[model samples]
Target: MPAASAAHAVPPGRTRLITRPFRARRIRRALFCPQILVLGLIASAGAAPMARAQDAAVKEAPARSSVAAEIRAQVGGKLRDFYGPRGFWPVWVEKDAVGPQADALLKLIDSAEADGLKPGNYDPKGLRRAIEDADGSGDPKALARAELALSKSFAKLVADMRAPSRAVKMRYLDPEVEPRDPGPADILRAAAVTSSFEDYVEKAGWMSPFYMQLRKARADYGKTWADLPDVAVPTGLKLKPGAKGPGVGALRERLGLSPGGGYDKALAAKVKAFQGDHGLTPDGIAGPQTVTALNRGPKYYARALALNMERTRLLPGPWVRHVVVDAASARLWYYSGGKLDGTMKVVVGAKESQTPMMAGMIRYATLNPYWNVPPDLVERKIAPKILDGASLQKMNYEALSDWSANPQKLNQSSIDWQAVASGRQELRVRELPGRSNSMGRMKFMFPNDLGIYLHDTPSRDLFGKPARQFSNGCVRLEDAPRLGKWFFGKTLTTDSDTPEQHRPLPQPVPVYLTYLTAASGKDGVAFRPDVYGRD
Candidate 1:
C-alpha cells in the first residue's frame, strides 16, 4: 500500500483536468489554423526548407511547438501528467538527436527477458525504428514520437520490475500479500527528475540486492541451458560409477560434460550436482526420475527462472533484519544486519491449502497458544468425525459461541452436528492448549488478514522429510523456541498455564513469506516443484 506521505501527493485527476483540455485546445488551434497549419505541413513535408527556416527564425521553434501539440493530443492520463507540466518538452530528445538515455532505455528493454519480462511487450523493435527515424531526419514530429515511445517503454519496464504483472497476480498472488504497484505518474515523475536518466533506468531506488542476485542467476542458467539440445537418457536405464552404456553418454551430454567420458567419478559427481539442484537425491546415480528431470531441459528451466525472477521482484526490499520463508522449498531464513543468521526446515501448506506469498511485521509471540481451527476444517473434517461418534473432549476440541473476548462456550451435545457437517451451520472450534494441541507450545504472530502465522507443531516428523508441505496454509516451524531466541536474544517462556499468552517483541521484525520455485545458490538456481501450482 502507498504510505501516508503518498496520499499527500497531488492526484492525477486534478492535474489532468487542469492541463489536458488546455493542451487539447492549443493542439487543435495549432492544427486547424490555416497559416500555422501550412507552416507545420511545410516543416513535416520538407517541401520548402527556405520558407520553413524563415518561419522557424521568426517564431523561434514553431516546429517543435507544433510537434509538442501532436504529442499532447496523442497521449493522456499519466503520460499527459508527465509531459504537460514540463511544457510538453521532449525528455529523450535533445538538440535534434536522441539522447544517451534513449539508447540505455532500449538496451534495458532488450534485456528485459533476463528479468523474467517479455521484451516484446515493450516493443523494442518499434522503439528502435522510432529512434532511428528521429535521429535521421531531426524532424520535430519524429523526435516527439520517439521521445513519447521511450517514456512509454520506460514506464512499462518500471511497472513490471516494481511488481508482478496482472497475469502473474491472477495465477500466484494473494490479494492480502500483493506488492503495491507504483502509479504511472509516480514512476515517470521519479525518472523525469533524475539527473541521469540512463542511471535511473538501470539502477533505480527499487532494485535491491536480492533482485540483482536472482537476475544474475537467471542470466547464468539461461546461458547454460538456452542452447543445449533437449536430450533424454534412455528410459529405465540406470547409470552408476563403473557402468558403461549409451545412457551414460546421454547423461554426460545433458549435463554439458564431455561426450567421451564414461560413468566415472567426475560424471557421477556432475550427476549428483544436477540431482541436488533439481531437488532429487544426490546419490551420484542417474536413475529414471533423474533422467526424466534432465529431459525437461532448457525450456522448462528457462521458464522457471523467469517466473522466479518475477517473484523476487515482488518481495520486500533489502532489510537489515527479517525472516523470509521460501514456501516452494519449505525453508526459512532469518537475517540480521543483512546477513543470514540462521535457516531451518519448515512445513508449509499442502497443495490444496497453499501457504500464500505475503509479508508483515512479527510484532509478538504467543506462549502456550490455542489452535483455533479454521471454519472450513470445522465443517469439512471435524464435524463429520464428531457426527460419527468421535468424542470432542478426547480430541481436545472446544466449541466457542463467538470470537468475541468474553464469549460463552457452546454445549457440544446441543449443537446440530449434521448441519455443521453438511455446511449449513458453522462453529468456532478451537483445540485446547496442551501437549496434544496442534499449535505446539508457542506461535509467532504477524497480524495479517489471512490469519497466517508461524508456529510450532506437535508432528515434528514432517520436518525431516524432503518435501514438507503438510499444513493448512499456516507455516509450522521446526523450532519455534529457537526462532523466539533469535528475536529476543533469550529463550521465551511462560510459567503461567494461560493459553494464548501474547508477549510483545522488543522490536518488530519484518517477515516476508515468499514463494520461489527456483532459488539461487553455489550450485546455481535450484529448481523446486511448484507444489501449489503457483509457478
Candidate 2:
C-alpha cells in the first residue's frame, strides 16, 4: 500500500516513471527553457565582442586620418616656406658670396642633378661630395658648390619627413644656427667685390695684405701729423700739401738721424730707404702712389686682405695649387706648392666684353678649335669688316650659313654692318677649323654659354708687349702649350690621341678662367695697367 502511494506521488525532481501526457509536457518545458536561457547567454557574450570591435575600428580610422593629415600639412608647409616672401637663407648667402662662390654653388647643384641624383629624394651625402669635388675655395666656383650642397641638404631633410617613421618635428629648430640674415655691409662688400671694375682694382697691388699694412701705417701717421719730427727738405724735394709731418719724423728716426737738421739732406736718406722697401719712386718727395699707401687704414687693409682671400675662393684648390695666371697682374706664375714654377704674360678681355668672373672644370682640350666669334664682336667689330671686303680678307673672315649657325641665323650682308658696329647688329661669324684659326694651336673649353675660354694665339708676339689686350674677348695664354701639357700631362703628347690615352687620373681637373684685378706681393702692392680698359 505504501509503495503504490509513493509511485502515485512521485515528485518532478526525482521522478523514475511518468504518464505520456506528463512526459510530453515536461519535454516541451525543457526545450523551451534551454532556448530562452542559452539565447540570453549568447546575446550577452556577443554584446561585449561587438562593442570592442566597433571601438577598435573607430580608433583606427582616426589614427590613419590623422597621419594622412599631418603629412599633407608638413608638405604644404615646406612648399610655402620655400617660396615665401621672407626668402631663404641660402639664397641670401649666395647673394653675399657673389662671383666664384655663387657660381660654384649653382654649378654643383646643376651638375649633381645632371649626374642622376633625384630632385625629390636628394642625397645629402651626394651633395656634400659634389661640394668637396668642386671646391672653388680660392676659386669662384667654390661658392656655387657650397650653395648647391646646402640646398640639397634642405631638400633631403624635407624628403625624410615624408616617411611616417622618419618624420621630424622641425618647429623648434634654432634660428641663429640657421643661415644668417645678411646686412647692408655684407651686400655692399659683395657688390664691391663682384664689380667688373673692382676686378681691376684688385689686380693692382693696392689691395694686397702688405699694401694694406703700409696703408694703415700711413693713416696713423696722417692722424698725428703735427707730432711728426721735422727733417730738412732735400734739394729738388717737392713737398705736397697735407703731407704727414710725423711720418717724416718717424722715417728720420728709423734711419738713426736727428730731426730739424738740414731738411733736404736728412729727408733724402729716409725717402730712399722707404722707396726701396715700398717699390716706389726714390725721389725724396711723396707722390700720389706713395701718399696713397700712407693714407690706407686698417679697414682698407682688411678689405684688401679679404679681397685677396676672396680671389683665392675662385680657384680649384688642389688642381690650381700651381697655377700661374694673375688676372690682376696681367701676368701668370706657375707655382708647385709654394714655390715658383714658371711665369708668363697674358691677354685678357676688352672693356665692353669684359671677361666674366666664374669658376669651373676644364672638360676638354682642343688641339685646333674653331673660332666661334661672339655676337658682341660681330656687332662691334666684325660687322664693319664684312662691309669692307678688303678688311674681311685680311682678317681671314668667313660667313656661317643660316642653318649651320648656332642660336640664330646671321647674315652679314643683311645687317647694317656699319651701323651695327655701334652695338646694334646681332650677327655672328665663326672661323672654320684650320691652322689660321684665331684659337691658334689649342683651346681649353669649360662649356659655358658665356662663350668664354682660354686658348693659344697666332699673335704670340703680343705677350711681349707691356699691355696685352688684343683678343676679341677670350684670354690668350703666352705658354698655352705648356699649360695644356700641365693639365693633360702625357695625354697632351705631340702625337694625336684622345685625352684618355695618357695617364689615368682618378678625377677630372677643373679650370676656372676668372677676371680679377688685385693680388698680394712681398714689397706691398704692385699696380698693373688695365689693358682691357675694364677699370
Candidate 3:
C-alpha cells in the first residue's frame, strides 16, 4: 500500500480531485442494497444485458459429427471433460447466429481487466473472429473448436477470479486456513448445468458481493486515473505551516488552496488530514515524503486497488456473520446478518511480527484471561529482566511448572534465570489476571495453532494513533466489551479473580483476518501504508 497519491490533491481554488470525483457515496450505498437493485444498476450501465432464460427460444440439440468428436478429444483438460458428456456439438452457435450466451460471455471477456484479469488471456478478439467464421461457414469442426474455446476461456476466467496463482498465494500467505477454490473441472460442470449461462457470465452471480464491490472499486479507480488532469506537485519541495516560497505555493495549489497565499493554518490542517488518510504522520507538515506521495498520480492508486481486489478474492464467498480485521488499515469491520453492523480501530501485528491473514470461527470468550507470555518475549525481554534481579511479582508475572489445568507455581529463586535468558531452558511464564494485566479483562478465543486471537489490551491509548501496528501477531480490540455485547447479544461481566474462565458464545462467528492496503469507502479508495510490506 503506497501512500495515497496526489490523485486527490487539486490546484488551489479547484475542487479536490480526491475528495470530489472519488467520493463514491452512491457506490457504497449500492454495495449493501438488494441483489436485484445491483443487477439493475449493472443493466443500466450497459455492462450486463438482461438475459432471461425463459424468453430465449429453445432450439433442438445439435447433432455431433465424428470430426467434431475427434477435435473435442484432441482439446483435452476441463474443456474435453465438459464436452465429452454432451458430445462435441456447438453450445454457443445456433444455425447461422451466435447465441445470446456467447455474446454475453465475449462482452465479459472484453471487460475482464476491470476484475483484475488480463483481457488478452481470454483472447476476446480471436474468440469473436472464430465465432463469426463458425457462424458463417457452418463448419462442424469450426463450431466445435469455437465451443471449446469459449468454454476454455470462461473456465480460465472463473479459475483466475476464484483464486490467485500459487505465486500470489505465497505472497498473501494464510497457511492454516485454506480458502475453498473450486477446480476448473467443477466450475465447468456447474456452469454447464446452469439454467442461464448468459446470466452467470454477465451478472457473475457466482461471485460474492464483497468481491464484486472491489471489482467495481477497481473500475472506479481506473476511471479516476483516466479522467485525472496532468497535475503534479513540485518534486522535493517541503513546506511548514509558516513557510513562504514558490514551493509552498505549488503545494497549496496541489492541495486545492489559494495560489498566492503562503502556507497558512488552513493549509496545514488540510495537509494533516491528507497525511492521516494516507497513513503518514499527521503533524500538518508537508515533507519530502508527503510530496513524493502526492506526486504519485492516480494511476498508481488504480493498480493498488486492483491488487487489493485480487487479495480479497480468497476470502469466504458469502458469509452471513463475520468479523473482518484488516491489518493494512488497522481496522475491524463487524458484520452481523450479512450487513456491516459496526466498525472500530484495532492494533495489529507490527512489521517484526506480521499478523497473518486467516479465517477461524470464534467459539468462546475468556473472562479475566491470563496473558501467557510468548516464549520469544520471555527469552528476549522478561528473562533478561529477571536475570537482572527483577522479581516476577514486581512484573505481575507467575512462573508455572507446566501449562495444564492445575499446574504448580514455580519458585522464582529456584529457577535458573541465566539458563532461561540464554535460550538453553524453556519456561512457562504468564501475567496474572488484574487491572494491570496485558490482556485487559477478557479475550476472544478462536483456537488457532498460530496462537493469534482478538483480545482486550491494557494500552488503550495506542488506538488514538493514526496507525496502530504495535502487537505480537495478535489483534488488540479497542472496545472488547462493545464487541462482546454484539457477539453474545448481551453485556458480558465477571468479577472473579480466577483466570481461564470460559464462556461459550450463543453461536460461533466466523472471523476473517485479511490485509487490504487499499479499501473502498464513501471517500472512494483510501490507500494505507503496507506496514508488513506484503504489497
Poorest lDDT segment (10 consecutive residues) of candidate 1? 13-22
TM-score of each: 0.61, 0.46, 0.60
**Candidate 3 C-alpha error for residue 37, in Å:** 22
TM-score (C-alpha, index-matched) for candidate 2: 0.46
Residue by residue across 95-138, what tens digits does model 3's lDDT show?
Answer: 33345667677777777777657989988877777677766666
lDDT of 3 at 518: 78
Ranking by lDDT: 1, 3, 2
Q: Taking the tens digit of each residue's C-alpha lDDT, what string does model 1 give over 416-448?
A: 989898889888999999998889999998887
Model 1 misses residue 307 by how many Å?
0.6
Off by over 4 Å in 3: 1-112, 117-160, 165-167, 170-177, 181-210, 226-235, 239-287, 294-302, 387-389, 403-406
Specify the highest-lDDT model's number: 1
Error of 1 at 212 (Å): 3.7
Off-target runs (Cα >4 Å) in candidate 2 are: 1-266, 276-278, 281-288, 292-302, 313-324, 333-341, 391-394, 402-425, 433-436, 467-473, 491-507, 513-535
User: Over the stretch 70-167, how does candidate 2's per-residue lDDT look in tens digits?
Assistant: 32333333333432222221231211132232233333333332222454354544654444443333222443444434433433422221111111
By summed lDDT, the worst window of 10 consecutive residues in model 3 runs over 5-14
